[model samples]
Target: MSDNSRLLRRLFDERVRDLGLTAAQARLLLSLDHFPDQNQCFHADRLEIEPITLTRIADRMEEAGWLERRSDPADRRARILHLTGKSRDIVDKLQSTVEHLFEDTLRGLSATERDTLGKLLDRIGENLARAREQEPVHG
Candidate 1:
């Protein structure tokens, strides 16, 4: 899985280089695009990254004018994330690149095979989540 992830990242990076985005940055932007109303902490949880790391990324992206952070009206302590015009301009192209990559990667798989693989991966993910939940905490 790690190998596959690395390969996909490599391909993604190659494709998005013209947009001046690293794979991680692109992922962050994509996440914000999908869940515009969420705060940075929520995004960190969804991205499975440490909050500080996501904050750092958010800092850089904000500096670059790719996104903005606004205080949530319902929760003053939380900040909602939104894409900037620059990010909005490129998001559709980024999504297209990702879809193309997926299609290329799954080119030879039959529909049934792809469906089976998806189900198996989902089950594996559930098992991993269960294992993590059952793990004993260390102090």
Candidate 2:
């Protein structure tokens, strides 16, 4: 837990909350933006989240109009999640603010330093992801 990104996320969450979106709703929306090309089906196995937990989260998002769960066209009965217009603008604003905050935070860093930090951060994130993948999911 040496990672300090939680503070950044908290700030982002506050901003989103002010705009009428819960943190989870905002994240679900951003996740959609992350895979703009992919249709509703997110590979639950690849996300390293427990299927049950992800299902609940997705269900909540769907309930809030942030997204909808529908049968995958290629595999009917397999639920695929998709974002709706309800969350689109709020998500866009959150993303823009995140980008601006990132740029502002790294404003003083030289290009080489930024590159190095990016590489290091990516490595650290991969390590964390791997660790999380190994942890048993508890209901």
Cα error of candidate 1 at position 45, Å: 2.3
Alpha-carbon runs more than 4 Å astray in model 2: 1-3, 36-50, 126-139
Q: Candidate 1, residues 107-131: lDDT per residue as tens digits?
A: 9999999999899999999999999
TM-score of each: 0.89, 0.70
Per-model RMSD to reference: 1.6, 4.2
For candidate 2, lDDT tens digit of each residue in 44-81? Answer: 45454566767877787778777877666777667767
Error of 2 at 87 (Å): 2.4
lDDT computed for candidate 1? 0.90
> After best superposition, candidate 1 residue 132: deviation in angstroms?
1.2
